[model samples]
Target: MTTNTPLIELTAWMRGRLAERVARLIDAGHDPHTGPDLIITPLGTTGEPGTRADRSCDRCGRFVSQGCILYMITVQAAPRVLCVGGLCGACRRLEDGWQA
Candidate 1:
């Protein structure tokens, strides 16, 4: 299996977990619409080329300098398209378990 396969599965599992959490909240008589919004966004991959001076790495929370290579992560769920954040090269690899 490819590296992306596991990441994809992990995201799917997270979606299920989110659903369960929402169900529990509803069962406890909480107003669904009043509760915090639940969003399931897609994972970002490394190797894409981009640069952002004002963005921080989503995983490591480190600021990337201007002209530095960064990865753009976009999450798509139904009608929502969230352009989450950029990931530094190191964090991006670590996120995918590509680093030891």
Candidate 2:
């Protein structure tokens, strides 16, 4: 639990990032809202201490060779949604999981 960093600011930042991420998905011919969550885990960032999660679409699930987008959903903890595209990807041999 990293202290000294406010949670609100983190969440707000996450929201903005998430918004952009979803937008990028739309640009890449994918539905942001429809993408299924591929992974969920507590974020371990040094500064951005929030909930970092992973998600992907059907095609992305197969085509994506890296890890799922390293995104943080802090709406409940903070107030924003942060999603970084091309951040992470999923693994096929891992059995329904990502290595973010």
The candidate that achieves the highest lDDT relative to the unseen native structure:
1
TM-scores, one per candidate: 0.41, 0.28
lDDT string for model 2 (18-71, tens) is 455555556766543433432221222222323222233221232223343433
What tens digits encode model 1's per-residue C-alpha lDDT throughout 4-95?
A: 22344324433453455445555776544433444433232233444333366755657777778768754332222222456789866654
Which stretches of candidate 1 lie above 4 Å from their native place? Answer: 1-53, 77-83
- Local distance difference test, candidate 2: 0.33
Superposition error at 11 for model 2 (Å): 2.4
Candidate 1 CA-lDDT value:
0.49
RMSD of each: 9.6, 14.5
